[model samples]
Target: MIANEIKKRVLIALLIILPILMAPVDLFLAPNYWVKSLVKCILFIGLPLILNNHYQWVSIKSMLTVTKKQLSLIALVMIATYGTIIFGYQLLERWFDFSMITVQLESSMAITKNNFWFVFFYIPLVNALVEEWFFRGFGFLTLKKFFSRRWSYFLSAIIFSLYHVAIMAHWFSPLLFTLLVIGLIGVGLFFNYINEKTGTFLTSYMVHAGANFAINTIGLYLFGMI
Candidate 1:
């Protein structure tokens, strides 16, 4: 009973508090971008691996592989997600001005724009892999121990969405931030859904990386920094 209570408390903090704390730490405490990203990766990915393993909160598995059918579906979804983002951005550009939007993120994205190859390569690969492993694989599964499967999924989504608060609130207008909250929460839920449905972490990672690729590639180019 004592052990179970400890596990529940730990998982609750991870799922509820860690994500909220991430923004402030990155925004105020971290000394530089390098440290900020490293800190985030360690907290989001490393801490879970260490604690969850120690607690035996989940079973270890080969989360990197997908069957042929799953692979095909992932490919189709990747293409569709990338295409949709591109199309949607084009439509937005036709009507609204994004100069204000781009400027808000200029400092945050300057490094990305300068390191085009890094953004093109790392963001979609290693970064996505770690995030999926942390959130869907560890965090969501841990919550399943204390909650129903659907509740686990939703809570994971909430944590993921809240994790971006510092960025969204600081780098976006109120209206844009509100919209982003809704969108990213939906995305978080969707990724968890895909992970559960396909029974592999790679599928959800692909969808996430694909979406980032779509947004970042065009945005960097437009900023004239890439």
Candidate 2:
């Protein structure tokens, strides 16, 4: 029993630290978007799969299951998520200078007009799935087994929000950056709640995808692609 407790503690440490460490890679090391994506996949997707093999912390089969009611909730949440994001963007555009995001994406990630479509599709679909699987499936749901509901929710949410800090560094004004981080924490909590209700991260993934859809739509407009 002591051995298992020690192992759980070690796993928790890794779960908390690995993504924090990966933030630097995104911020400083990765030269382009594909490199960043590959590193993220290896760290987020690969590590979780490997750890699950040894620990059995998550049930892949159960996580995939969804009911009709859950599906309806997913749809509603997704629409609301998309609408909320788009509305927020429109409301804040005048004050926030969001066009800087487009400039940063292009200069930092090489996200040009040619590759924007691929990124647009990838962000909302594939990237969101990877995040849901990592933050919700591995981080929150798995940690909930060893921690209290509140701690699990807050730890997972805070880490999820922090993980984006490196990516958004210098992308916004200080006030906007702070606000965005707080908003992310709220979104993380909402995603956790959806996963808790549905017994799966897939529901949260759909909502995340919707949120990404809104962001990428703004990206499209900024790129003058639409």
Taking all chains together, each candidate's TM-score versus the true structure is: 0.88, 0.96
TM-score of 2: 0.96
Each prediction's RMSD to truth? 2.3, 1.2
TM-score of 1: 0.88
C-alpha displacement of 144 in model 1, angstroms? 2.1
Q: How does each model score on lDDT?
A: 0.75, 0.87
lDDT tens per residue, model 1, 166-197:
75566655776787898888998889888878
Per residue, candidate 2 scores C-alpha lDDT tens digits across 47-160 of 878878887776888888999988997899899889988898888888778778888898878899899999989998889999898999888888888889999999899999
Flag regions of model 2 displaced more than 4 Å: none
How high is the lDDT of residue 85 in model 1?
91
Q: How accurate is candidate 1 locally (lDDT)?
A: 0.75
Root-mean-square deviation of Cα positions for candidate 1 versus the true structure, in angstroms? 2.3
